[model samples]
Every structure is written in structure tokens, then in C-alpha cells.
Target: MTIDGISSTQGEDGVQEFDVLIIGAGPAGLAAGIYARRAGLSCLILEKGVPGGQVLTSPMIENYPGFPEVPGMKLMDHMAEHARRYVDIREGEEIVRVKGGERFEVSSGAGKYFSRALILTTGSTHRKLGVKGEDGMTGRGVSYCATCDGFFYKTREAIVVGGGNTALTDALYLHSIGCKVSIVHRRDSLRADKHLQESVAERKIPVLFDTVVEEIVGADEVTAVKLRNMKTGVVETKPVNGVFVAVGEVPSNQLA
Candidate 1:
């Protein structure tokens, strides 16, 4: 069948062919599909999940050029819609294996596809705390993105585990939203920019230095976290309703 006026033919072996195959449907992948179609190349986008990638988890975005403020889901929806008008997008297709050659061969659970060129736009995954009860408490009270989960903790208590920009920013956001926030860093000092550190201090946010979370404690939901002081070797269980682990991110390049 023809998609977006680009001929997508299934060969006798049931392999769909395209000029360019994009392995993700995030901002970069969507943009690449649009550009490829505009250049008169037949393109296909294979996404394992829904479009939008990690941006979908963001609650509010103010840094985007045109709109003063927009929801992450809304912004990604607009981009995906625009891309659909130009290229063929196949969502829910996770690429399982890829073989390189004069023409790349890509395989998914459904079938195989061939493309002269391949674009890998896979994004990143959030790093986890790896502490006890963290996996079981996920979605019950554990979250990786503060902007995504901070709304649930307003007027409640939450702890951000990290000293980087993302962690400090999350703490500031939680505070602004009326959540009693604290910072738990394994290091003595924060690694965030000076401005963000100043903002945290200006807001008088409490930061626990040289501290690490040993375990997340809860029955159904998160009730507290077991913290260990590196210098003094003292262990304490701090009561909290939410645990926002923003240590860092690892690239989602397994398919590549």
C-alpha cells in the first residue's frame, strides 16, 4: 500500500521497504521523518510505545521557543500530528534486532523491514535508586521525574535523591507547589549550577549532605526512607509521602 504518497511495498517475503527507517518517535525521530519525507524519500517510523517519548511525562514546559508555557503531552501531540501528514508512523512496534549491510534489515515482533538508511533516535531512561522496596513502591509513591509527579505531593512531604541540576530543580518545584521538600545527596556538596544552588538556599530548602538512601519503607504506599550518614554512619528513617529519584539518566540505546 502507498502511505503519504510514498510507495511502501511488501515483497514476496513480507518485508516492508523504505528509503529511511526511523527507530523512535520522539522529537528527534519525528523531526527526521518529516525532513526525510520533504526530501522526497519514503520514510517509516517505528516506535515501541506511543509517541512523545520522555517529554510526555513533563507536566509543564516553559523553555520551548514559541509558546510561553505548554504541557509536555500537548507539545508532543502537535509535533506528532504535523509529522503524520508527511511520513508513515507505526506506533507500538518495538525493534528487536537490527542487521547492518548495504541495506539495513530491522526486525520487530510483528515482522521485518528493509531500509537504505537508518536513524536511531532512541532516548534515555531514568536511573533508579536500586534500594530495597523501590521497585515495589514505583507508581505507588516512587517517581523519577519531579515535574511529572510533584503535583501529587503538594502540601505533603517528599525527598529528592540527588545533588544535580535536575534534583535541585525538582526540590524547588516541589517547594513552590507547597510540598515540604528535602534533598538527600551522597556527596558533601551539590553538583548543580551555582544559580540552582542559590535558588535552593534562597528558598531555605533543607539539604542533607553526605547522605544516602538505604531503603524505601512502606506497606502499600511510601511512608519513609532509610537514610545513612556517610560521615557519622548514623542511620535514620525519615518520614515522607513521596520519593523522587532524579540521580541521572541512561541512554536507551539497546536497540542500536
Candidate 2:
């Protein structure tokens, strides 16, 4: 077969060839693309989702090398744009299977391509609570991102899960925007940095120790959450319009 009446001779195997194939479009993948392109290698980046990855969902980033307190999406955009100048990137293309051999054959739904060197920068996915009403009320009221769903909770009360850096940061952001936010932690102490811990105390944000989110309660939107005391086995219901799950992330190392 041929396109535009021309022969399609991608060898007999029908796989496109490339010197390097980078999977993912996050910071690591983009950086790899830049290096490969600068080395004068035929490189291609296959991104299953958006180009910027999790950076797009970050609210604010303060400690990135040069920039001070820049928006996450803005920072990721710049990184993606900088890589685009030298590398060829294909967004919305997922590398479903990777065949190892003398050369790696990358297969996706769109097509198949072979590369001498394969680099996987598949970042990570947010871990879910798997509680009742969570999967059903994802976008409606329950969310995993503060930067993406914080604005919608203006002047409303919100509940933040976990006690890590992400959870603390999200709580502070929510409080800043007129939302009365509370932290529910399964541990007595937070796993965040000391500075953040001090800030949380300074901000007077309530943290329920040994507390776990049992269920996300709401109808059309999130109205409250059912929390259980891990130590005493006492269950309490708190009114909240938003719930941000910042528990942790599951690495995308399946291809690796």
C-alpha cells in the first residue's frame, strides 16, 4: 500500500526506524530529547497524554533553578518549548509495548517504530483512595490535584488527605483562597519538611492525627467526607466541598 500513490517501504516489517525513541513528555523525557537531538541522532518522543505531564497540574513552583515562584504550567510549557526547538515530539502517542532485542521495537496504537536506543521517562500516576463514592465523583467534587481543582472551591470548605509535602502545600493554597481547609493524616506527625511543618502550625491549619478518610460523601457535588480514627475506631463526618487526595504516586515503570 502507499500514501499519495507512493510506495510505503518501511522495510518488510513495516516499522519506522529511529536512532532514539523517548517515551513520555515530562521533564525527564524532554531533557533526554534535547540531548539526543543535540547529538545529531534521529529522535522521537511519544507522549500518551499532554506534553507537560504533572507539571501542568502544579499550582506554583518556587525552587526551580532560575525562576522564583513560577506557575507549574508555565514552567512546564517553557521546558517543552525549549525541547521542541531541537527534538521532534509526537503528543497523544502511547508506547503500548516494547520489544527488546539488538534493537528495541516500540509499538503503539498509531503505528510501530524501531529504535536503536529506548529511553523511558514514563513518570508516575497519582494513587487513588479507592473509597466509596470516590471513583464515581472524580471531577464532580473529588480530585487529586490542587492547582487544577482549587479555584472551583472558592470560599468553600475543603478536606485534604495525607500528611506529606503535597498535602500541606495543597492545604495552604486552599486556605489562601478563602477555603477553610483541614488536614486528615493517618499518622501523628507529618512527613513533610520542617519548614512546612512550622508553616502549618503558624497557619493554624487543623490536622487530625491518626485519621483516615473512609468515604467521600456527596450527591451532585462533594458535600462532606467520612473520616475514621485509626486509633480509637471513632468515625466522624466533616462537611467539605472538596477533597484533594495527595497520598502518593505510583511510578510508571512497566516499560522499564
Best-performing candidate as measured by lDDT: 1
Per-model TM-score on C-alpha atoms: 0.87, 0.90
Q: Mind giving the per-residue lDDT tens digits that candidate 2 earns over 18-75? A: 7788999999999998998787777788999878988888778877989988988899
Output the lDDT of residue 212, model 1. Answer: 99
Show the lowest summed lDDT stretch of 10 residues, model 2: 1-10
In candidate 2, the residue pairs with backbone N, CA or C atoms under 3 Å apart (3 or more residues apart, or in different chains) clash, namely: none
For candidate 2, what is the TM-score?
A: 0.90
| Per-residue lDDT of candidate 1, residues 1-256 (tens digit) | 6887888767548788888999999999999999999999888999999989888876666679997889889999999999999987889999999999888999999989998999999989999999999998888899998887889999999999999978887898899999999999999999998988999999999999999999999999999999999999999999999999989999998977
Root-mean-square deviation per candidate: 2.3, 4.0
> Can you tell me which runs of candidate 2 are displaced by over 4 Å?
1-14
